[model samples]
Target: MEATIHKFEDVLIEKNEVQKMYVNGEWIPSSSNVTRDILNPANNQAIATVTEGGAEEVDLAVEAAKNAFYKNGWKQTYARTRAEFLLKVADKLEERKEEFAMLETLNNGKIYEDSLVDVEDAINQFQYYAGLATKPHGQTYEVPDEIQAMVVREPIGVAALVAPWNFPLVMATQKMSAALAAGCTVVVKPDKQTPLTLIRLFEIIDEVGFPKGVVNLVLGSGAVVGDALINHESVDKISFTGSTEVGKRVMKSAADSIKKIGLELGGKSPNIVFADADFEAAVDYALLAIFAGAGQICSAGSRLILDRRIYDEFVDELVSRAKEINIGPGWLEETEMGPLISKDHMNNVLDYIRIGKEEGAEVLCGGHQILDGDLKEGNYLEPTIFSNTTPEMRIVQEEIFGPVLVIQVFDTEEEAIDLANGTDFGLAAAVFTNDGAKAQRVIRKLQAGITWINTFHPTFNEAPWSGYKQSGIGGDLGTYGFEEYLYKKQINTALEVKPSGFYKG
Candidate 1:
């Protein structure tokens, strides 16, 4: 069978409803009756409208989640049953893969192909956590004494998850699936900018028959709904993915109630190209690292650290390839890169490009907006590259969250390591080299949670995903991620019921 291509008009036509929040297995509008228009970003069109949920609605969602955990037996559900639910959800998601992918592309403004990959990753995430749900959750230890003690993992009760807009469906699944697999109930607040896909996901969840309130969706601005969700006394844990500033705020809010928190925050990841590296492969990976998602990726390697020996040639080739990239609407089959998430985002990126130029860095190539026919209204910016950037430049230090790359040259491996580790973030980094021993040595000292040698941004579900510094507090996406929604308890049984000899005289 041939692959099916989705048109933006068709996606919009299919998405006819004025979307609403999903709470306690019901489709409802916000208590305030306020709504926000959901933009396509590709063409600056309002494709849908969603409830602008606030504290009132979040309280309701949290109350429902608490009830599900304490009153509805969700927290006590068997691991196999939870796993079965997860698998069923995964199947349902796969059945609607195209629809979700189209929604993701329309809402997030990423290339359709990237949106499809996001759906695939989300499916894999659910399936992976499904398997983990039924696996061994505790350890048995041999003791010297007669008493037997077991360390068992139990659900951490209600989890409040906040997802970012970059990979809407995938990030939601990353947090929700793990929390569910661990037998915890959840209330998810997808980024208000791109809540369409997640809202649809909850429709599937409701159809698949999760106990009422086991999973809920509250759509709204973060400042409004997010405050109530994280600071709720009944919320046992908080899992968030977004900027460092917002992550810090979530941490503070969660601290008020002393809830367990896991954050996957912003990054200014480094992509280093060594002198002896495979030049063409390094360029390709560099492109993948920075421009794959139009640089909206939290782990985008926006900082390119190049060996001075091959710096000029590598940068020239990289700039050439970047210029050749076809930038347009996501639905275009031939487009390689898509627009920014919104006009504000595009302007922000253009401001960074200006700042990079003002700081004495050369605009290597493609730093202007594409304001031509049919692209005038959309949020499109060229994949930008800057050279001669210094460590102190704001564009080099800050997370632009755009399709912008800053280049800096290094003379030695020690210098490269220092440059890579210089940033406050340690979320991700990549080292390109052919020498195996050098690759290992450099990666070991790279001071990042996730590192790639001869690669860029490929991650697996079987491994943990996290950051070393302020990039995040904890991780998500593996055994470590699965355990974040669980807490350990020790059960002790006495071998003898009789009391010990002589207490008082």
Candidate 2:
């Protein structure tokens, strides 16, 4: 399909008003009668309005999903049938690829080509889960005393998924597809800053003939809609993707109801480079790990830990390469990096950069926001690089979800591992080294959930993706992810033979 670039006014579904919430497979206004404008990150213009849902909307969505789980046939449907519907959704997404891609780019301020890849990846996630719907593994066991036993996996009902704004459509699809594939009903509260693409996605879901109440969407701030969803009694599970602080709050809320929770939260991941490693390949991987998606991804390698032997040369090369990164509007074809989600977020990133400088780090390259002639209205920041950073600096400890990289040097592999594990987060880490034994040892010792050897950010649908500590709980994007929304049941039956326990009889 050809790419389509849409203006803010031309392709939006609703203008100057909150697009109605999708409940029970239909679009309707919130019971609260309140709405908020959804702004385009590129120009900070109001592109559309989204429902300002509150506790009341949360109740309605939960009730609808509960009804769908019990009263409706969505869960009871055959696994193959569910797979067929998911496959159909994937097909429809492919059919409307250009539209969804344009909406994602406009809503999230990612480059057009990158947004297209995200749409394609989202579709692939649906397709992958569709294939797995009928393939859940069950175990049959033989009992000792004339009893037969078997274990089956059952869907955990009414999942409440709260997605982050960084990769709106992709993250929503990741949780939604996996839950739906497992025959669970879902109520999603997309991040308010980037709700349009997800709302548009529900439009397609409605058109694809999903049963009423199987999937629903509500929009509002995290404090409003997000909190309500987490605390709802009927919600059986909570899957969230955002910051560690918010993840802790959600975990506490879920604790009240004892609801199952899956969290993919913040990261201060490290990308370690050894002197004997493939220099060109390591540089390329490091660049993509931080610059791609403006470094908003939780798995982004924000810390560059280099062997002290080659620290000076690596910093020079990295800085020189980052200087050439093209920053412009997402819609432009030549743009490599685009604006942050909003001016507020841009300012937050800038504040961190200032903190890095104030804390005694050297600015190796770009540090200021870019407000050039044509790009004045957008929230663009130059690809930033800092050197002479210590593991104790705030920049190395906090998740600066922007295109910023902090460089630090370590003398030995043991010291590098210690430095990498110093942070509270343990989401992802990478080691670039030619020494096979050292790489294996480092991988085993790293506290992160996902580690790369001589590479970075090579995620697959089959691998479990989550974090170890404050980064979050549970896994997403694999068979393990599917199991997160499912519960296990054991069944036992007496055989024809009578037990001889009571031999006196």
Candidate 3:
């Protein structure tokens, strides 16, 4: 398929030579002169440069966030009034959806169609949190002996949100909308590799007249800016979405001050295909399970567990369909998958494929790079499939974070459930079965934070999402996500001014 040429300059404003970070409502240069080039992984080209912030910038950003929370009307505003601002932000996002979506594709190498969904989800998140904003408060409880008591939910103050490169805008708003709804000030550090989309999004945020310092943006490498944000004393809470290894570091750093933390981390999710499942439907979903986002999704169903009865036929059909997917640049209308996020990531995925072959797993199809014609300069990996895999292989044990699917056969329902629960990461899993009773059984038995029955990768804003065990801590989305930014307090009031009977006696 011939890829379409996306002239980003036509849609987006001319690329500013250096995109300045937003701090205290001002677009300013970094404290240091350092900067990083944001690349378009589609062709390994530098698309834009952003000011790379560090400890000094984080200090300023956190201080600004703290001031906005304590010394301004943002926290004191009525819930409905806050909801109005959120609604406006959502409207603005809708108006500029295409521009942001295309920018995301150019910046992150995700298919333009999928990137549009990210923008739409971001807009919906703002709207959902806008509704929730009006409904998050304290409750009054009846008490005895002229004592009245109530529980109040208050903002946790300055929040530092660190978003990942994979789903930049959606994850940012997932945390940002919730924190803002709870009336907390925010300092956001978008991943340095793909900061353009969020930078554009923040322009709308600033235009909406969100109080100065209410929403701040910093652009920098994770080591310098991210560490400073997590360690800052003024930051009351931290919400991060990234790898599990980094999540541990964030948790340890936040533990020292007992700062509130919410983490949405990695996964090696399983997709079980039961013998009784609709054969064609399972095949289609299984393809989307791993190939969607080119398997860069945190919850990508990388482990395919097949019932022994359907194992041979299913693997054959899956390999046949995998070979037919169109691979090219994300902007192409016909392209089904895009390149890996970056050259380094592409190498990492390729290394896993090599390791799978060395470990004696059979490659059913696609185990090499596609460097032909227009794909030569890009980081395009053939959607690879490895069959005859075990639960103990490194390819099965660790997250490849690519479009490499490992196949495992199961003889019984118990074995399928056990294999799904075998991994250390329990972020997400799906069970494909025609029987409602068996679906319920598998859903209950699976150890993942999110589960799908006869479906794959479908999520809504109304539900909470998190993981079990090493998948990290806390959750995002839904009322649970909104509450993560809030701290509760109990008020005990005396209805009558009377001394204690014991003291009087």
Top-lDDT structure, candidate number: 3
Question: How close is every model to the real structure, measured as TM-score?
Answer: 0.97, 0.96, 0.97
Alpha-carbon RMSD to native, per candidate: 1.7, 2.1, 1.6
Give lDDT for model 2: 0.88
Ranking by lDDT: 3, 1, 2
lDDT of 1 by residue, 1-505 (tens): 1243534545563345678888898999988888888898889888888878998888889999999999989988998999989899899999988888877888998888889899999999999999999998688778755678889999999999999989888998999999999999999999989998898888789889999999999999888888888888989999999999989998887777789999999899998899999988999989989998899999999999999999779988898899899888777788789889999988988998988888899987888989899998899888889887899999999999999999989999999999999988999999999999999999999889999999988899889999988899889999999989988999887777677557865
Model 3 local distance difference test score = 0.91
Model 1, residue pairs in steric clash? none
lDDT of 3 at 378: 92
lDDT by residue (tens digit), candidate 2, 1-505 = 1234444335676575558888887888878788887777778888777768888888888999999999987779888988888898899899878778778888898988888888898999999999999995899996687778999999999999999998899889999999999999999989988888788888788988888899999888899889888888899999999999999899888898799999999999999899999999988888999999898889999999888898777778888899999888777788888889989899999999999999999898899988888678888899999988887899999999999999878998889999999999999999999999989988889999999998888787778889999998997999999999889999988787666576765
TM-score ranking, high to low? 3, 1, 2
- On lDDT, who's better, 2 or 3? 3
The window of 10 residues in a row where model 1 has the poorest summed lDDT is 1-10
